[model samples]
Target: MSEARKLLVLVGSPRRDGNTAMLAEGVQRGAAASGTQATLRFADDYITDFLRDCRTCRRSDGECAISDRFRTLFLEDFLPADGVVFCTPIYWYGMSGQTKTFFDRTFCYYAGSYPQSEEVLEAMCRKRIGLVLASEETYPGAALGIIHQIQEFSRYTHSEFVGTVGGIGNRRGEVAHDPRDPMRGAERLGREMFTRHYADYRADTPRSTGVWCG
Candidate 1:
């Protein structure tokens, strides 16, 4: 039989058992049921420092000067994954600091600073990207900024933007009681993570007009 697809889930929340973590767990379960090997990693555990000035800290070999676990997490866990899911609690109406820092460090690869820049870019293009967010507000646009950011990231990397799941909650474990049932959506997204392709409904539907649901 063919090898199982690998999924890397980066949890950006500091709270190990918070609302965001719960949603991530649901996604993992769904991915597992679909025969995917899911690896859940906490950003707080591996990432300690933010991306620094590349001019002063970058190495000749294209590695970041700041020493941390992020390098290994990126080169080994992230680059090898067939699908990647970013799980973060919406902080100040955007992705958490950990998640933002993780993306910031990828600048080296995109800047062609790496020796294997071409290969790294190629690998990124072949993967599928997903997002999971938990927030205190259920407002319509609370998570829009993050969603747009992830969409743009996928576009820039030439990867498929699978989808996103947003949960509403303030206290720990409150997401489980959300009426919107974001956990279920998270699971569904995970199950289809490997096979789903994003499409603009407005473009696909000929009769569509200027109405924006989101």
Candidate 2:
């Protein structure tokens, strides 16, 4: 028997049953149909309070210092997952502060203070595939910027950027209500993930070598 693949979906919206959640649900449906384990995690459950910019983890065990509810996510759930899906609603032309903060805190692991070899970071990246699903009712640039952020994340971490699905002109379950919109795209993305073993193709080098879109 083959091992079951695992995909982690992170919902960055504070509201439950929102557009982001709906998209994540679609992705989960696809993953399950393909025989993969799809895990959904909501940021509302992970974030307790606003992050106050404590970089202590950089100085210590390469772990975030403000350690509260999110620590387990950073240490356990995130690192071990075979793939990652970030679903965030556009806020102020970018990702929600909650999602941004979560990515920012990961700087602890990248600071290289734990004496772990670059090989370790490379392995972490190679083992993961990242997906971003964002939506906004207005300017599509916001969603584009969020995707760019994910691309940059993959580049620096040497991870795989599997692509993103953005739904424009939608708000508060608008996409969810429409059956032909995001859910269809999200499910297709999930199906694609199941067919490919992302970890095998991901490398420490960018796909275009500094030309962006890693």
Clashing residue pairs in candidate 1 (N, C-alpha, C atoms within 3 angstroms): none
Per-residue alpha-carbon lDDT of candidate 1 for residues 1-214, written as tens digits (9 for 90 to 100): 9999999988999999899999999999999999999999999787899887787788876777777888788888999999999999998899999999999987766566667878877877757999999999979798999999998988787778888898989989999999989999999988989877565454457644455444
lDDT of each: 0.87, 0.69
Cα misplacement distance, residue 174 of candidate 2 (Å): 1.4
Q: lDDT of candidate 2 vs native?
A: 0.69
Cα RMSD for predicted model 1: 4.1
For all predictions, the C-alpha RMSD in Å is: 4.1, 5.7
lDDT of 2 by residue, 46-160 (tens): 7665554444423454445564677677657777778888888788778888788788666545445645535446545854554655555645565677778887877776777
Model 2 — which ten-residue stretch has the worst lDDT?
A: 53-62
